[model samples]
Target: MHTNLSSLNAAIAGKTEAEALAVLADLFPGEVVFSTSLGYEDQVITDLIYLNNINVKVFTLDTGRLFNETYLTLQKTNNRYDTKIQVYYPQTAAVEQLVSEKGPLSFYDSLENRKECCFIRKVEPLNRALKGAKIWVTGIRAEQSGNRQDMPQLEWDEAHQLFKFHPILHWSFDKVKEYVKVNNVPYNPLHDRGFVSIGCGPCTRAIREGEDFRAGRWWWEDESKKECGLHAK
Candidate 1:
């Protein structure tokens, strides 16, 4: 229940983004981890980690249904950074059971089905990746969505039993793109095509102008708040 982030915030105050991450890396040693989705924001974080040689573990969850552009981005990121980002996959048995029982496209059937697929493909794999990690780094920017607008730069993740540090939480989306461009970081090309939040190919689409950022994801559902359980509170 200890959630005071002031001390941690002050620790990184006046430091550069990579420097702040380096501070956390030093503070937690091998317990610091960052999860990337190969998006613009995450690409920027990956640049900072690899470009700066920060001592934090970087990994991604392969949901077995991601866009080809996503995998291409991962490859380009690895080549650009000269480091291989660790990948975690859903347990084989669980994926087999789900696919054999409900078929591959069952997530479109109902919210429950979608959530089940998300849990099996993303949430569970993420849980396994974050096991024993002390600090969970993320590329969460406040401007991305209304729900994330009030997120603190650093906070305790009760569910993960660790601290979640959003190094660029207050950064604007434009700033994120600028960072990626300036650093020459490799990113998913789908972002240029209007895919704001890239996930599984079948569940995601490119959003048009004036649409909400979350609209492109799970467009069929009537629910305004569409999530795949990765950031569920």
Candidate 2:
């Protein structure tokens, strides 16, 4: 069951990430999971989990279109932490059907077509990865998007019917970067090259200085259609 954000925040207030992890360790007491995309925020959370020796499971969706740098970071994370990071892939039939019908570049045509691609490649697989989990941990920060600005540090994910926790929800991009640098955590190299929001290869690009943080993702579509449905309400 999802608890109210205020109550959850009060419970975790004044606690460090390590303290929070200890509380989560006792709260769930079994099989807590954290999903990552090898982004800066995710890397910071990954480092916290690793350094604190938290028993939470860390995993990622390998949408089959990730950047080479993302793949390398995944490899490096595994090598450095000496812990297994599970990789989830989309179902073969769903992927084949979308590609076969849309020719893999259908997102260039219309919003519906792009959403169709995202549904098959990301949303569906994420649903599977989250199944049966009591808590869903993410690297979501309020400043990341307008829609996310109102998000709380912890809330019930009514969409997924689980408690959703955002340890760094109030953190700034600079703070996330600082933590990553200070901790020497492994992150995607593309971040340094201007990819603020990384996703699949065809849909993601580098953003300009004045562009929106998410402009690089689905650059062919309007702002409202930027989401891939995983974060949709």
Candidate 3:
């Protein structure tokens, strides 16, 4: 709950991804953590952490509703990096209660139901993953969504009680793909099939060309209500 954003920002100022991660490791030590979705940008950060040997705990949420390709990429990444990225699963009791009470496809019925499902499967587990961490690193890029455009590269997340860092906040989609290709980072194959932002298997779809990056996610909902509460400030 104690972070001097200015001093930490100055420490990482003008540093490469590896250097910035090293700085965070020095600042927070074993308390630094990163959550990866096995996407293009996350893969780049994974490479930076593993290749540079940064002491950061990496984890991913298994929502019990993910694409096969995502799992494949997760395995490939583990193989490539020779590391076992920790996996956090939703609490079984909560998931059982939700499904038993509302049925399996209740999320498609209304926004409230969708949010509840997301809370059970993602937000709650994310809170558990972030517990006792001083730094919560992510691969959020500003160009990915309108809501994220105004977010700083590093900022305090009051809800999570941690300093959130976006290492490639200013990177473009092409640049992310370039880094992945050049570094040989393992990424979800769904990206090549037009799935710009991959998420739950039932909730995500491929977007047509000229569409917003987030359009593929929660496509049934209005654009303003697309967030799943995991990234909601």
Candidate 4:
């Protein structure tokens, strides 16, 4: 489907999260999909879609390296909403080959190795999850990373061949947390202990008091190389 980014943004302008999601679901029906990582922002989106009963398919990529808390949050969300959020996983053969050839922890050796692992675990599965979708919704916030600062609320993703929308793109961290709290959404408990970004457990950690929002992810790498290719340009 051909989408005009400017017109799409204008259509959802100033609408509440649920309202905007309802509009998208009505417009695309089964063609709109939302990907969540069980983070705070994602919990808010889950609430918007599930609680409001929007006609959007929700799914998560299970990389097998996720935190225990993430799994628990996923379970809690499913029970609370009475919805089964679909799961997409990396192909078994690709994962076997990568681990067999490079060994676990090879991602620490170089940026190339890291991106390769991410491609096997995240990017590839993301492509599968996004198949046949006309729109891909995400929980990205501009303030979370410099890479996303220039992203608009609506944009065409050439790699995925769909329009990607960030419902809370301009929202603040505090605003997201407050929404989660007020809505009684289930979120990863790691956020309470300084883990600003929750990805695969091995590559993620809690940040210090004055650290950047994304510092907790791939902490050893240069700040510019931290993205895992799932959201890269």
Candidate 5:
């Protein structure tokens, strides 16, 4: 880990998103890029990047199984921001190989199968999208999952060979919603319908009140194995 995590903590201790973004811009210069899923927090970060005219590249993983609402949100964000949000897709051969060997819903069979699906649909494409990028920005928040609690705002990603940055690491869900509403940023409509942590269409569902933010994702699996391979540090 090559980041000055302590300095990042101090700089963002009481600062606003705008302040944090400004510092990030100064620190990363031309190497910053924001990866979005178009969720509420991602939308907030997208809005911040747009509003400030940050020169960061914006991209998304268009897993073939994404919800219709997610695609709609992507369209809306492009129209509203007038910026091209690059979409990355998995290699055709890789996807075809997986589907050919094990049917489309193989992820429901076992943990190994699920990880295989994630690797083909998300992780591989994400790795390609981040090629040559120095700073990988995300909307990850600590409260989203138990495993995410110890994440820092800035850290070294040995897997990606770059610095991973979580701009909203300490933000609460309420704070994220407030920022979205206040800024009128475009977001996934599924969020309004109860999908807290939206992912692939077949793997995600709506969560009830008081459930964990990520309860909607991979609800069929054990809580410890809920994550897709994209965000692994």
Candidate 6:
């Protein structure tokens, strides 16, 4: 069913995010999957999928270092939708080896060490979760980061050999917040505390006034680009 990217893009062209999501669900049925982080942006996408009654399977990666508030939001979202968003975890053996060799807080030491830890914890689990998925849904927005500003709403993910759809790629942060509030969607309260991008607890912090959107995550690394391997090309 996924033999042509042009057809898929045309099918979703000019449609609203929810409408496009429904189109993908109809096109691929069980092959469409969504990854959620329970943040404001993701919570809005969650509402869109659940309310629209889309048949997309939604899941999240647990890096074993996420904030407690994020866990609470996950539970609230599950209860609200009566749908069990799947949970994927890092492999135990790999985690043990990495921790034993580099210690638990090795991600703070250097950019290489951080990316290695991210690969073992977040990226590896994501790969497993998306094993047979044909389309991967996300909450990525252009205004969130500089690199994402030019991204299209729907595009092919060459690395994973699947379609990556950011339903709200062009939506503003205020729009996301408004949708979450209007729909009564469950979201991580950390966003209210200036923590724009929530990931691992120790690796994240609240940003200050006039700071960049991703300023909170990995603030220590000045020379390296501030990103985990999750969304890297």
> In order, what lDDT does every prediction score?
0.89, 0.84, 0.92, 0.90, 0.86, 0.90
- Candidate with more favorable, higher TM-score: 1 or 4: 4
TM-score of each: 0.95, 0.94, 0.97, 0.96, 0.91, 0.97
TM-score of candidate 4 to 2 decimals? 0.96
Candidate 1 differs from the real structure by a C-alpha RMSD in angstroms, to one decimal, of 2.0
lDDT of 1: 0.89
lDDT of 4 by residue, 48-134 (tens): 888788999999999989999999999999999998999998999999999999998999999999999999999999988898998
How would you encode candidate 2's per-residue C-alpha lDDT over 106-150 as one tens digit per residue? 988998898888888888888888888777888898888988888
Better TM-score candidate (1, 3)? 3
Clashing pairs in 6: none
State the lDDT of candidate 3 residue by residue for 33-151, as single tens digits. Answer: 99999988999999999999999999999999999999999999999999999999999999999999999999999999999999999999999999999999999999888778899
Q: What is the RMSD of candidate 5?
A: 2.3
Query: Could you give candidate 5's per-residue lDDT for residues 1-233 as a string of tens digits?
Result: 22566765576566676676776667667767888999998999999889888778899998899999999999999999998899999899989999999999999999999999999889988988888787888999998878788887878788888878788889999999998998788889898899988889999999998888778888888888777878773
What's model 2's TM-score?
Answer: 0.94
Query: Candidate 5's error at 158, in angstroms?
Result: 1.6
Clashing pairs in 3: none
Runs of candidate 4 exceeding 4 Å displacement: none
The worst-scoring run of ten residues by lDDT in candidate 4 lies at 1-10
- Where does model 6 exceed 4 Å of error? none
What tens digits encode model 1's per-residue C-alpha lDDT throughout 88-175?
A: 9999999999999999999999999999999999999999999999899998888778888788888888888898988998888899
Worst 10 residues of 2 by lDDT: 1-10
